[model samples]
Target: MNKILVVDNNPVIRKMLSSALEKEKYQVECAEDGLSAFDCLDRFVPDIIFLDLIMPNINGEQFCQMISGRKGLEHTKIVVISGVAVEAGGECEMKGVHASIAKGPQFVSHVIDIARKFTCDHFHHAGIYQVFGAENLFPREISKELLAANRHLKVVLNNMSEGIVELAVDHRIIFANPAAAQLAGMAQEKLLASDFAQFFSGNDQIRVIDLLKQNKIMAQQITDNDPVMFNHQQVAINFLPVHDRENSTVVVIIKDISKTKIAEERLRETKEYLHSIFNSVQAGIIVIDVETNIIIDANLRALELYGIAKPDMLTHDCRDLLCPRPEERSCPVLQEGKTTHLTTQTVKKRNGQTMHILKTATVCMINNRQYIIESFLDITEQKKLENKLHSLSITDELTGLLNRRGFMMMAKKQLRIADRNPGKLFLLFADVDNLKWVNDTYGHDIGDMLLVKVAKLLASFRRSDIIARLGGDEFAVLLSDSSPTGGEEKISARFESLLYEENEKKDLGFPIEVSFGVVAYDNYKPCEIDELIVKADKLMYSSKKSKKI
Candidate 1:
């Protein structure tokens, strides 16, 4: 019969181990700690010593070392029995230790198997050591708790997504979970028979070997981008090194990061496509982080528009780029919770030149983060063209003065201001005298020349004055604020002096004359521009009749 000495701090565990060993018809003795076991060993030498790592006096490590050095006990086998066997596998595998069994549901059975292996005939019975009537063997309460804990632990390990593997000191896999078997593309038996490091290839194998040789816990064995592969799947490896030199082992944890890696790769590809579109599109594009309101990215067109480099533009506040005034810094879409915004606005460039653009801002989500995409279409030239077209619409083609439509528009505005502010506003209307006779006598060219000359004389008024040719040899002027008091005398004298100078030039064959009407607007009562024109016209015809008399 094999003589086995069970040593542990827990009385129940020691009793349990001894009871199971004795059930196999072996001579078994129990000790509460390493000290008691050694005292028992002084007279009774066990063929195999079941040891516990943590004890009150003389721990298992010291007992193993002392027994390993002691004479007449060279052939005795040492088996470590401890709750921390998996965590301290290398520590438990001392010089004398033949095996290490974790204190679990299988612990008592492992003790029986080791005892039978050393003492019984080889190949006697290789199966789980089933203690018949286990209820009778252990106290009912403790037995239920232990069985429940073991069953729970087994369930958790078997169902875990991370591959759990425990290796022997010789690099043989001693245990493997279903996840490990799945990751290795093999059965649990095949995984147990194979070397764990053989699953890795090239530098990955080198990294695993280094982790084992270092004998330290490493959270990750390789870089994130370049993870270890098994069965054509990306996996991250974690190593928990056993601390004992004689019983050195490694526990590997394999996690499937294939989904995470694939997601990252897809994100990268999407960014590449966005980058391509950003530069290729004619519009300037900028990406902003909604949380920070910062410009996180800018395309080539945006960089060119800003006259800045991409690196310089990045990390700048979006408001700094888009808004020149502090009051305009608030984003309409972001602050108002709107989906998008569009506007025709002006932005200043690095060169301090103002640029007109049709800008669009949109809220977008990318990879679960909120962002604003601002697109700018340069409309500076387009704006210039629009203004030029507008000018042509309301401008007199012949005299470069406000046309009839433009005159009415501006005159109405000034009348409203004068009405509210109670200011002096002068309206002057003039008709070319003898213009028809000049056209009939000296030809229409000279008559046109005379009309142009009169238009020039009217322009001599202050720029604030509104001047217009109201069709045919007729012209009108709106003289405001800048006109001195007694404006009618000033107007008559100014035109008389201009006419005298033009007739003296002798380029014109005929003398230039004009009948003028000056009317003071009623500031208390506003009137339409056409009404003002009618009053001014009646006065002008009266002046013409007095001139004829």
Candidate 2:
């Protein structure tokens, strides 16, 4: 049976047309509006469409043009139905409309005759005009104003810069405006004659065909976010479905976005280029938004230094991550109006451990927004080395005791303590009596061993005593809270016995001897450390002379 689609907003006209067509055994579908008619075409491809010129959403003239624009449905016949012939006369004469039916008392017969003529159905009713009150349906004369208005609409479409094309269900172009022709890189006449999909090859053609099917079947609009190459020019395409009661049409809007696409590609490449450079540097770099105090970006080194991932490193507050102290919260570069700063700072890592860093922070403007760029190197190891070197400066390399400089500094501190409290402090100075004689007879190495033995013997004193190798063959000790003059004599005798025992061991292959002097400091009569050292030296030499005797 021939399929007939009746498109009209009026229910009565739809009923009248459907009844007439169905009586002749033709399959009939009814739609109230152009959109509903398009939905109806999803299931039924009608052989003929009974279109009304006046309807909601898409009027009859638009419906006729859309139907004729479809690829496979070009052969489908359209007959316009009009209640007031002159009012819709210009639209009724649209290009795709094959015939016109004037609505009147003879509407039924006029509808039947037109269906019969188009379908060429074998079942024909004799005197169908008289049987259903049929009459000849002829095209009415249109007003000059309506014709001029139609011409104006065509003129506007031709003048638009955006390419406009109407495609059929089969992805074929049925109508294209002048801009569309130019976008396709072909003359308007040739573009209309050629296939639409033929303009794009390979995957682009496949994608466009799939898009058209979706648009037509779904009766919705689809737009491309990325531009596709059309005729060697980048263009953005939009597929909008325009449906008639019988067939589906998709309006494709093409915009030339080649320059925009190029600009976007260049911008993407520039960002990648800058990112590579940012990550390749040796220093850890972090960019912070000065206003928000948020870490806006960090490079690879920065991420590694903080023991954090890039995503977690960003958006962190500077005060929380780098500066934990309230006093250190103020940024020097930002508040002090300094363009740059070089300072040492402690950074807290993700694991809660702190690292010492030599950081250089600079203030800069990016896109008119203030930001701080912080570049730093980890100096925790360097700081440790410096502390070690400082310790070594105040210590004797061989004896592991405080040197002359270290002894003077400690002895002065002790006298200062003695002044605060009444205490008997003793400064003992000793000399290696035979160090030079041993050096002459058994080489300097043995002499050095003898001197070391004396140092060890002296170190045997109480832990509270400060033992120092003042220089070669010379040593000093500061004893705090010692006894009276009798107690000092006993302490000196105890040290002399320790040396006598070392000589019996023959540890250095020779005997060890030393001369010593003890000078007492009265807390009530505060004396300078230099004067104490001089007094001890004189007494030490007198003791050395007695050792020879």
Candidate 3:
């Protein structure tokens, strides 16, 4: 096995070169810097030294200069490796080195050829081997070891993810790897010996060829974020200028960056989608620093909420805006650093007018900093609508009285309040006499008028009383207070007086008569509202039966 030395500052590049050389059964040693390579040189005399031009401590030019004056190592060959084009034509032009190969796609094959020239027995300068037919690039034997080694080189190029192509000094691609053919979306044979300019699309071909014409290194453009397209496929390309002291072989590396470009586009699109949603939302969203409690970012709705734009909003303290009444107000969400959802609060606007708002806030960690994501909705109009809906849900539309549901809800609440004071709660169930007969003879309009009249009579019954129309021709009344106990008698007397007054004012076909039933709630011994209602209903039915007889 031939002993090869690889000296490069980059560990990854050194490892890659060492692995390729070792695969060809060469004993490879590596050094990180020029100083380290010098130390390795004193101990191990390699057959071919693949020297890097630019490195820390002692560079390739310095290393070559130092070694030229020394003795006994005259048989050892130096193949200078220059990553830059200038270094190959300038530094690697030193008389001591046998050849110079640029660091690029053809790097591995160059190392193998150089190693074979010094070690292999059946190497002919002409019949030895030819790569791209540009110059002598391979060493060969008639059979066996050389044939397998040649196959191994082909396999390595075939398996590489990046496309590697050997171009002549005219920029015509003489050799194309399987990866290069795949990237170009064509067969390898179809691309071989084709002009390199034809593979690239758009203005990239001009810029690329111009740089190549100038014999410049593509390393600077390779490190750039922008990539070019080849055969409609996105590709990052690099050119390596390989000088053999006589002629130059320019190798092109094409790396497919389509997936990476697509990912970047998707991420940008996702960011735009999120931004649209944030601004379009009805809720005013504001992001504030948790430590300083200052407004950092806000959406359009948030700006509208405060009547201010960005820089102005940034000046305002978020806590001060929310808790303007410092003496009387404090935010629990801010203090506790926890989520508060749909909390109803009255906020004073910039104009000093108070508006009701439903605010929600949560603590969030953004970029390793604590922030509060606060969202709020102006619910002043909503509150007004909600109160109206609440009233409609409970009260009857026609008579302006509590419906059955409304009566029960308030009755329950009032009963609880009265129970605390331990006052007697009286329930009165009232029904109009001959209401069915009135509807049958006088029609519904007259029947409705009669119902309304009775409802008006009971409208001013008592302040503490909860009065409601339980159903058709039936009503419920709850009276519970500390002051008076003759509530039932008062209702009876008022009903009779209204009945007489109506009869006197108009000549009616029949008289309006009302029947009443009363029950007293035992607060000391509590019971449900249903029991009191059932008891009152039974009493009302009994009174009706007595009057009928």
Candidate 4:
């Protein structure tokens, strides 16, 4: 019979528990106080302890802590019976108590059943045959055959990689394989009829009971508070529910998932470390669901850029987030099926401030779910520098207009647009008269100032016009939606008046004279933009010669 120790300050309660356990054929010892219980532990090493709180000398929580810290009493299970709430009992359980029972006047049988269930043996061991007279009945040959069969069965059960155990409906253990025994840190024979709760710590027993009652197969990693001894070694355990068809009994599989648990702990630590790094990163990061296009995760930089306290507020699409104007189609990231990179796209921040951002996106899978990782680098300053470099490359510094190369590029694009539309295109080619005379009479600085003034005067025309400094003392303008008869006359009159006003002011330090030739492409289609430019150039030379004569 298994021995039990019942400790309680209330003499009546102590007597009742002792009598009930004794009736169940268990050797029961009674202790009226925590001090007495501690004294009892030296001589009578009971298998289980029924502990009570609110005792003299030491409180239940303190006693449990002391007992749990002791090495010699490691296998002795302690069940707390207290007047406190279940939560308080759970706290005590965390201190390494095996289970807890509510203090009440009734339910003595239930308590005894709980205590006896942990002590019974449900399996027939090898020594049972000799003790029960089964060794003399069978012939030697039949006995050898039976022994061989039993050995093979035990070998098969022991070799199974998964921990397997069978329990009776009354919550008594019926059988336990070697794996199950190792997981629970008890011999298979000892665990055969033991109470299943003996294998679980206090709070976990409640959860285990709930899972078994529901008959649901649950898979989860659990951390043990009171560690169990397995093969003379302490180990963490993972309990997995196994489906059984025969006898409709519960078959639980246990595994020593200490390594898996360690890996998960490391993963959690790594995740927290990365989260810290992400928040401190300079670049903004946003993680979105590929299918729903919802922002699932965002770093601190992204939240700051969006000016939102939480990620849930931003409801606009990706295009709205990045584009200066509303696009007729979605952004390339959404339109393209694969990862993409975009440069020099204008994005509006939450404050309605517009800036340039260089963005890249990649598709990644996490926990079997697909997500898009979008990274944004602020490029407003970079873009400003790039624009400055481009201007230096393609613009005449003195004239403040497109140089020859820039003019050619703009003219080509304008001609393409003009060919597709029904609008008229006009080209004005002009040359400053007597530039060498101005340079020789006045200083070169004055001549340079005259060129600048001429470029400004041309730019003062309609914004729709494209003005360029073709070369030194030469300028070109491309006007769209203008006619040959009406547009040419209007442009000539405006040019004459502007030149007269400028010469009257003498801002150029000399009489500013310019020769101009205007040509209109009004249904007079040319094969290419360069062809039209050549025609206009020839007409300008003719006008210059005429003016000189």
Candidate 5:
């Protein structure tokens, strides 16, 4: 007989496990605690140990560790029984326990099967353990094949692309595959005895359970993008119910469609990006499909111009939705078949509100489908004060270079590219010398002109580089493909020589002197682009000190 030891502090649990194991014809032994279990081990060498984690002396984890290190008991399988979280049971496995079973009366048959699997020939005469009286339901010869099939089915279920879970009719989990456990953020053994409602939040639990009771597959989109918070993370769940005619068990497959949700989000962002650009222009933008000549997409300005209250009604064919025109009124842009930057007259708005609107349309393809992009700039209020103010915020009033905010935005983009390529990036800090002398001698207007001239010179040098004026007499440049030893120094020296030449040629009451310093990126060390600027600033101050000396 294959000797099996059942250890638990609870007498009822120990007796139930012993009865289950004896029914499978295994030689069963019982112990109330770990010390008694060790004594049982000394007398009878058991093939498998069923250990209860919470016991009086030397709990299951410690006992398993001790027994696993024994010289001849290396092959003896240790199965841990626990009412705690399954992660604790997994810790026991890492310490050399072979399997873990949840402690419950309903889990008795499962524990027996686990024992029989490890114990070789001891339980062959006894019939396989079955729950819900499934033994007499199938023929004896087919029973073995059915058990084998179920084993294979479990392997397939565990490896499935989608998550699979089986629940008793009352909603207690009976089986859960690894993917299902991972999706639910729980362990399989712990989930087996848990209620399905426990996995969902308050309102979600009620919503999901009600849906499951209807026995219909249900899908809903979740929109939380944060990975840490459950509600903040988005996922689409599809629930399917499984029925076993003989056992009356219901299995539900839960699939996590986070990828699909991400795709939908990207699509929405693209639409919003297009809308932002469209609203920024004084023109109204409209998109139409070429194949069906249907109005597929339009911006808010376009809807306002057309005087349409419901935009969805315009999604139909353009000819059916718009006012009828002669056959000769075909768009000239389409006739050209190339990018047409010409102005054309059109009666696009409602009949009563018809006006001479400048329309431009171009053909483009998105996602392998063809469409026409039409833009209509009203240009009615060209001299608006608010529009000019918006432009001034992004543009420098003195030097016409991008303002500090705009420069910061563009520099962030270049930094991202540098991070991806893992290459040398250089930041140059420049400060104009004798700026106070210029203001004292030549007046503030000439000082401003000198700054503007320097900005123009720097802008003409490298259009690709990001240039920004950090307040009066201070300017910064970001250079790509430059390093400390050769490429960076060469560029820095070229700029220095250019500044010296300009200063030597022009004399506007004060010298046009500038000090500069450069810092190259260290690929091995990860640092923010602003850190490079700080280093460059310190080096520039060092250069200014040397010039004074």
Candidate 6:
């Protein structure tokens, strides 16, 4: 099995890498830092080293330097894992490392590729070793096998797209491919036997001649984006040592990356500009994965609106801030399968205060992943203002009773219930006995007080009864279901007693008196609410006329 070593200061990261590699059936080892890793290397030489750039006792650069001149560790390739950007640079070359991969969503995949590349390289060499078995093969057969392998390698090296050149210990170009000669702006035969350092300048900060002076067996990479070469092309180069125990030679691979480098620079600039605009907008913005609802990105305004710290908001489920039922609440943005959706919701904050928010979510895709771009604004104050206006429109401010419009709306709902079930329904229409006379004698304030008192009296009945101030000196009530024993008569008797007691006290500016007319109906005998009101009005006038007699 291929051995893989993970060196990171974080235990979680170390365990995560180890578990993933182990699951792949590779022998994996974990170390806290460079010191622990050094101890690991003494016993077991891994095919690949997963090294973190930043660690406690010794950092990645120091560890690379220490391991570079080591005799037995020559074939081990260092795959750097760093929190910072690991774009193409000369740093990897100086450290003589194979590749640098930044910590990101795709880091594990990069590690797998590195492991596969080196494993295959070693596998090829092992195949050759087995073919020329020391115990079984004759000397003549071994020499023939070696020559055949050399001829095959020569053909493959010449066909490669990347420029390849073999350099001697004195930094002389001993061999050059057609691609290397073209990069150097020279003929392949002319490029041979020339100093390799002649093609590069000091502005790049890397000198192959100086690097070769170390005479280390490990391969080193040297990359330069400076447009100082032939036709001003950027270059990425790697010098790997190949030797036969006593004599050493270096193989260099070069690739031109001018176009790719330029494209990435422009892309980065565009991203930064877009990020500035994202945060500057007034609304709170959040981008979350569609399936998981895991918050991927959140802006400054989002932080302020939710009263949350940045770190907590990024990982928390988007629904936890609004709909408490997380899994039950699928992405509202995608509910109707629309690309965009507008909605309003009430969300509770860390402070336990609820806020009404107007939200707009647009379905978006980034790097082949589905996401919802949600933008919202707190509308709590606006909602409060709307509720106040609605209340004034449907409620009597003086007595806090439902106004005519409010009563009609509610009466319809109650009527529907009464019509659906086998229940007795009663409508009571009442008029203040002499409200106009009281207003004329003692002013309208006392008249208002009497209206309020009458409203309370009407409200004191069954809780299911609906009370409303229909208009001036007019009130109505809808009673559902019959009382088991004491019916409306019981309610009327108590109201009379309360009125007489109030009249006796003389606390009000005028004595309390009200005239009532009742109309009854059952589900079997259905009638329109308007017809019931007209019948009750006629009964009230008849009662009033009888009193006059």
Model 5 alpha-carbon miss at residue 255, Å: 1.3
Per-residue lDDT for 440-534 in model 5, tens only?
A: 88899898988987886677658788888877888888877644358667878788777777777775645677888988766577677678778
Regarding lDDT, does 5 or 6 come out ahead? Answer: 6
**Tens-place lDDT digits, model 2, residues 134-251:** 2454434554456568679889999999999876555656567899988887755455424678888888888777777677555443343656678988878877777767566778
Task: Write out the backbone clash pairs for model 3.
Answer: none
Steric overlap count per candidate: 2, 1, 0, 2, 2, 1
Q: Could you estimate the TM-score for every candidate?
A: 0.60, 0.61, 0.48, 0.51, 0.40, 0.54
Q: Candidate 1 — which pairs collide? A: 90-244, 91-244
Model 2 stretches astray by more than 4 angstroms: 1-161, 168-182, 185-192, 219-227, 244-248, 287-298, 306-321, 324-341, 346-354, 362-373, 405-426, 462-466, 482-494, 497-506, 520-531
lDDT of 3 by residue, 180-255 (tens): 9888778665564468888776688887778687654443245337778788877787788777654466778888
Candidate 2, residue 57: Cα displacement in angstroms equals: 20
lDDT by residue for model 6 (1-549), tens = 999999998888888788878877789988877656876888889878989876654457657766776777777777777654233133434455666666666667667655776777853353221110112222355544654675588689778888888776667666677788788888665665567777876754355565666545577766664333433667777778888744467888888776777887899899989889888888999988877878989988888888999899887787776553566677556777988888898888778899899988899888999998889999999999999999889898888989999888888788778888766787888888888899999899989988998898888866778899999999998886456654556655766776677688777845787887887765677777788888888877887777778
> Residue 94 CA error for candidate 1 (Å)?
32
Error of 2 at 196 (Å): 2.3
lDDT of 1 by residue, 12-31 (tens): 88778777888888898888
Measured on C-alpha atoms, candidate 6 has an lDDT of 0.75
- How close to the true structure is residue 240 of candidate 3, measured as C-alpha lDDT? 81
Q: RMSD, model 2, all Cα superposed?
A: 11.7
Q: Candidate 6 regions off by >4 Å?
A: 1-160, 165-178, 181-203, 206-209, 216-218, 223-234, 241-250, 266-390, 433-447, 484-488, 504-508, 542-549
TM-score of 2: 0.61
Off by over 4 Å in 4: 1-261, 280-282, 310-336, 339-346, 385-388, 417-424, 480-490, 525-539, 542-549
Model 3 score (lDDT): 0.75
Highest-TM-score candidate: 2
Higher-ranked by TM-score: 4 or 6: 6
